[model samples]
Target: MTDRFSQASGTSAVGGVERRSTRSWSGVAWPTLGVGAILALVPLWLGDSRVMMGIAVLGLAFAAYTIAFNLIFGSTGQLFLCVGALAGIGGYGGAILADVVGLPIVVSIALSTSAAALAGGLLSWVAVRRSLGVIFTGIVTLIFALTFENLLLGLGELTGGESGFLMEAGRGTFLRSQIPPYYLMLGMVLLTLFVYGSLRRSRFGWAFRALRDDEVAAELAGIDVARYRIFAATIGAAILGLAGALLAFTEGRVSPTTFGFAEVDVVVLVMLAFGGIGSFLGPILGALTFTVIDELLVEVGQLRVFIYGALVIALFLWLPRGVVPALDDLLRRRRAGS
Candidate 1:
């Protein structure tokens, strides 16, 4: 009787814990659903197709790039600046493979993404061999960006050099216009968010965080720091490559001018820093805010970049942890109060 009672009590406790977990998730879900509903209604309310499509496309692309950046920098604590170059490679490679080799867009995109992953792995291997800090990583990646740009510029036959190539309109009946592209981008963003969330909750995520926190200690704990770091870089690069391919398809063109190196790194860094580099939601928030600000300041001409730079500086000085962290803290406090 005692043993039976003990087992019953344990089962009851387990059930209670699960119920609490469900409630906690519901708390998060309701707010998310409410916000999503409001956003979804905006296009209908405004009835401006162009504005809606433009916002959707730009926001989605920015989010994709930011997520790729976060995979390495936020999770693995590695600073990299080659994302734009790799993305450009993916875009050009996909376009050429699809146009010249007669491969399907999907197949070409896969090939390009795979190539980018391999390149990223190789670069990570080289980077691991040296004890370069974040600044050094930025410098090395900047050199790579320059090299890639110059190489593409010289390869007039393949890349079309400065003139660029105009791809055939639409791949199939499914992806025809701005609306379709917007939906596709939304799907990719959701998929990436799911993948990232799962990854953060997995054992590999723990290993990554361990390495990020302290490489020496992680190594002592029998964690393969170098391998994990390389893995992060490779995966991050693949995402960037895929994002690039998507951008190419959306724009229906590939060009050297699209992947300029000068301010790419700064934009990425600012987004990551402003959104809170420690959380999954940081990149999304940062990307959306930055893209909106950028679009709003488009009319400012040359002064736009200066304004962005000032805002970044102000963010750093005032809220070093970024917006998401601050919001998260507030939420936690509210929950505690409730």
Candidate 2:
């Protein structure tokens, strides 16, 4: 893990440096890419396709989910709360189109992704028209999320209602073979990281940050706050939408339970909080740490739930910005003291 961090990132706090390094993109991305390359082969190394598949699917899906979440909530400071709903739109839309409408799986997923992006874009446009503030935006989106879930439940015949959507074995590309799904996941995650890294260093990212810091000041500086927010929402929602589509394959079905308030969105949000929101690799690290922690605690039964909750509280109390930021601060302080 240490080596992966060192090699993938050229950012440094050692030698009295207190900020990210001015490394080229390749240098900045090497560590993450290296780790991903190794992850790609874990199925062979672990000798248990099932175990490896579990790791890859869950980790990659949530990593993608959190990446989108980080872009809106963390980077741009838009409290866009309809993440799971948008993902569900993609998941259910894709599955129903594929299973019922008999569209090709790829086409279904593409349309579903587009639908999710359209939903996000519409929400952004509405929010801008209403001149909604952060809290109002969150409220409106949360309402949309709740409404979406109910919409699925209302369409009981189509969605399978309380029983959930049932996917037969060997249904989707993600289930064709464990290896294929894992590779797909690995590819998506790496691509997301690369895209995010590039975007973070681009003009869009700068505008996003400027909006995050001070909207009024950004507006004065000629930043079109409304336009960029919409861009973030559309792109981020599109990413989440794709993840949702992949998720249908991951679980072999679609369900409201899979994309509800206490499920997908909250999990991704917790991951972002634990990993240091807005930092490129923070949520990934957090996802890894918590997923392992959850797996380890499974044997402890219900006690693990309490433990997990306690840990989150502890994190907020002592390390509010998350593990990575705390470590960065510690390193900077030590260097200053020295």
Each model's Cα RMSD: 9.0, 5.3
lDDT (Cα) of model 2: 0.75
Tell how far residue 8 is off in model 2, in angstroms: 20
Worst lDDT 10-window in candidate 1: 1-10
User: C-alpha displacement of 37 in model 2, angstroms?
Assistant: 1.9
* Displacement of the residue 337 alpha carbon in candidate 2, Å: 7.0
Q: What is the lDDT of residue 24 in candidate 2?
A: 58
Residue by residue across 24-112, what tens digits does model 1's lDDT show? 34433443345345545545643357665666665776777787788877777667787778888788888888888878888999999
User: How does each model score on TM-score?
Assistant: 0.84, 0.87
Across residues 277-334, which tens digit of lDDT does each residue of candidate 2 receive?
A: 6677777777766777777877999897687678777776666667765686688779
Candidate 1: what lDDT? 0.70
Q: Cα deviation of 175 in candidate 1 (Å)?
A: 3.0
